[model samples]
Target: MRTGGGSMTTPVHNSPRTLVLSTKTWERELAAELVRLGHSPAKSRYVANKLLKRIVGRAGWQRQAFLVD
Candidate 1:
């Protein structure tokens, strides 16, 4: 799917448990959630961007596995 910064390709093995989100969308949502939890906007964005950068081009399973590690 087309995201703000780039496109995210869903893997072929799409299952109901597999949720794929674009980097931009994840960053925005993460930042928003952080802000809602009382973090500063700048801090929230910084944290979200840093976290999202690691999985920028990763597929859903790879991203999840990476995070789990």
Candidate 2:
């Protein structure tokens, strides 16, 4: 998705409070969790992406809050 004229793949500046992981890492961890719970690999990836989207959205909210403070 686009953000401030940049795509989501754009590298963001790192902050102590904003230690963001790579999307692939997030997806891998999420998928592993799902697999442990008996989900198929393909389904796990699909669900992981869905969950990661919401997580990234909330991360933006947190970043806004950080700026406000």
Candidate 3:
């Protein structure tokens, strides 16, 4: 893991359920809500795709992808 300048990057999945799934049964509904509020769902694979980043790719910069206002 990198700290104070290093090559290795810190592991991200340090905890389980750090980002939980959406309670809405319909994924489309949740996505619509996010879009209506002028925000975007990070991705559309899992119940909540906000925590996703491509393998070997940098983690997304936005922390609150699901948040509105």
Best by lDDT: 1
Q: Report every candidate's CA lDDT.
A: 0.59, 0.58, 0.36
Off by over 4 Å in 2: 1-20, 59-69
Once fitted onto the true fold, the runs of candidate 3 whose alpha carbons sit more than 4 angstroms away are 1-25, 41-69
Q: Write the per-residue lDDT of candidate 1 for residues 1-69, one digit (tens) a residue.
A: 223443543433545435456555667778988999999997899898777765554543433322210
TM-score top scorer = 2
Sliding window of 10 residues with minimal summed lDDT for model 1: 60-69
C-alpha lDDT of candidate 2 relative to the true structure: 0.58
Least accurate stretch of 10 residues (summed lDDT) in model 2? 1-10
Alpha-carbon RMSD of each model:
6.9, 8.6, 14.2
Query: Which pairs of residues collide in candidate 2?
Result: none
| Candidate 2 TM-score versus the reference | 0.52
Clashing residue pairs in candidate 3, if any?
none
